[model samples]
Target chain A: MAHALEPQAKTLAETGPGASFGVIQGLDPRMRIVVASVFSIVTVSLSTIPGLIAALAVSIGVLLMSRLPIRRTLKRMAMMDSFIIFMLVLLPFTTPGDAMFNLFGFPASWQGLWKATEIALTANAVILSLMVLVGTMEPVTLGHALHKLRCPEALVHLLMFTIRYIEVLREEYMRLRAAMKVRGFRPGTNWHTYRSFGYLVGMMLVRAIERSERILAAMKCRGFSGRLLLLQEFNLTLRDYVFAATLCIVCIGLLCLDFA
Target chain B: MHIVDGALSNPVVIGGAIAAAGGIAMGLKSLDLDRIPTAGVLSASFFVASLIHVPIGPSSVHLILNGLAGLLLGWAAFPALFVGLLLQAVFFGFGGLTVLGINTVNIALPAVLTWIIFGRLIAKGTPVQGAVWGGIGGAFSIAATTAFVAVSLALSGDEFLPAAKLVLFAHVPVMAVEAVLTGFAILLARQVKPELFYKGASA
Candidate 1:
């Protein structure tokens, strides 16, 4: 049943080099994107605990199918959980419902506990499936897919540009930090530290702007216009159709269980 | 500061999505194709910048330099920051897919607001004056963001009221840190590259 989730990848024959994909990577990118969104909406609408658990199960099932590193992906999900744990903890005390227990003289209601659980399960399920489905794809292909899905052309170009330059700028950032470290910079609770960090960011922005200027010049010299030609053409294979069918059936089943 | 998928009510989610879509369209309209490269690179730099952890007493908070982004990108900050948030959700799972719209609105709206309110003053001032305005803009962005986040939560249900309040309180130090860093960053940019803040109103 975990085979309910699938993905799309661009191999050497399909696209180009640096393809890191797995079993379900043969599915269509647009299909994966649509399926993930549908799954999230369904998961969020789920009210019953069992229904939500089923939604999470389906997400894990997708994770298994996508062949992503299981432990690492789940750990990331847990990290997100850590972010909201405080709010979840506050829920049991805040919601006015039947008293379940006492925490520091405050009544923790069962309804509140259930609400917290519902949120955790829903959040985890939606995010888990999202990571496995779309996150597994190459960022460039994701941009192309969004473009094909009728996203604004300029927005897609921005996404592609950001993806291409993130690594470059990250290297520049590391080099800057290295320089700062060599200067015996130790961040602490002080104004100097803040100012230095501020200067660091300011420096990065200045360099980035200069780099972009050079890039624009290079593009112009190469006879480049403003348009970015999205060269990737996605075709829905048999596997993609099967994946879509399975997702539809599974989502319907979850909704049934939720309303039943 | 990303609210997860199931945490928000449908009305809040839908409203945020619509609002973000409108903001993004406006932002994109202001950005012609030629400026795409500039905006894209700046957006990436901000993405990397957010990874920086500035120490605050016993602990540290990661930077959210939306104010700085606004001071540079103006209306374009919406789409630029949305790209960052989208990458975070997909690649890192920091935020959820459904909540992307709302998260973008919460973070980027304050950025544009900062640009509008403080853009001109920072540009016309001396380096030190520009830095001070930059600092206030930075704090204002975070404060507005926290307020937006709080309102998004409180609108969902009465149960989220306390959490929303706590969210605001927890961000106090973050605002202070962002302000100082943003001020210094603006100060440096003004001295070194004076055009940075000057372009804020129309970028």
Candidate 2:
């Protein structure tokens, strides 16, 4: 399905290319990576309502610690909610359980309501924590952290190159759109509009491929040997260890609360 | 389009993860060091595709364009698209962490399949001829992707069946728009850089 990364088109402008702040900024990038993954898995396995709420609370705590703008991060989480809202709204009607209410002769169920609430809580918790702990980190640091974490080298390289080029290509795209606007190209529900947009995409791809060729040549001239070197240095300090332990403890607490 | 975390049965989630891992392995195998820049740049290019919303009456829909990605990148579309999804989830909170595997499989599997089925035909013959095949391939990929997504939802539980069907039907218009756009895109590429389609490693 066609979905925008940000419904409001402000995620890029707001993050401004990743400004690390407060405690999350000071922690080792690798630590943040591990904590985010562990927390997500732990949150996913949680089922009880109270436990899920606490997970959301823990995520909020992380957001505060990261010093990311709270309203912006939660708004992004709400943006994701818009996509799943349809399925969630329909769940109560389709699911069989104790009756809650009726809409258009369709009886909604309490069990289905609980299920939707469960999903909503779990998704928000994971995404919120993820955005705070990992999303706010400079993308280049994330790549290097993955590299240090022993992810596949080529995959890491791809991630780095993609991060490096998104801004460049997006600028290229903006320029194209601006030129179209200057030419009185107003996109609408017409054959001509789709055709123009398609050509625009095609032009971007063609230019992208050609540009990469030039980059490869330039890199080769400087002894580029298929591998882009990552010169990031990482060392885990006591604070990173303490921060990771606290997160792990919180995760264990969540699992215990869910099961017990 | 994203399946946020905790929405699927454990088995479906695990199975999707395994499938995605296998696909990514194949994609990486096909992607040598020499092709990294090409693959990376093209992947970033497609990322911009989602930001371009085409107006459809009162509502505008962004472009997924995975079919065109399959045509250009072949098997390499797997990791390339995965990278895009990853960026979206981490940067924009667009999807979930645990569901990344399933989401990747849903989106990229169809892309690779389209490449397998239509990659060569879209490269050969006249520009117009290639574009016709490109259009077909574009529509086909969207169809296959929605089917996969619906199947994943249905498999997760009985409660999701209606939602599954709805997801499938809602994407019909997407298939048409994507088909036309992809056709025109291929037409442009065929006219400008005919050699772009020759890099189909899986072909």
Question: Model 2: per-residue lDDT, tens digit, A85-109?
Answer: 9999989988999999988899999
Candidate lDDT scores, in order, read: 0.88, 0.88
lDDT of 1 by residue, A10-84 (tens): 221233444545756888899999999999998988999999999999999889877777987898899899999
Estimate the Cα RMSD of every predicted model relative to the unseen true structure.
4.1, 2.5
The segments of candidate 2 whose C-alpha lies over 4 angstroms from its true place after superposition are A1-20, B201-203
Over B126-201, each residue of candidate 2 has an lDDT whose tens digit, in order, gives: 9999999999999999999999889988998999999999999999999999999999999999999988888663
| Model 1 CAPRI quality | medium
Per-model TM-score versus the true fold = 0.95, 0.96
In model 2, pairs of residues that clash are none
Chain B TM (all candidates): 0.98, 0.97
Off by over 4 Å in 1: A1-20
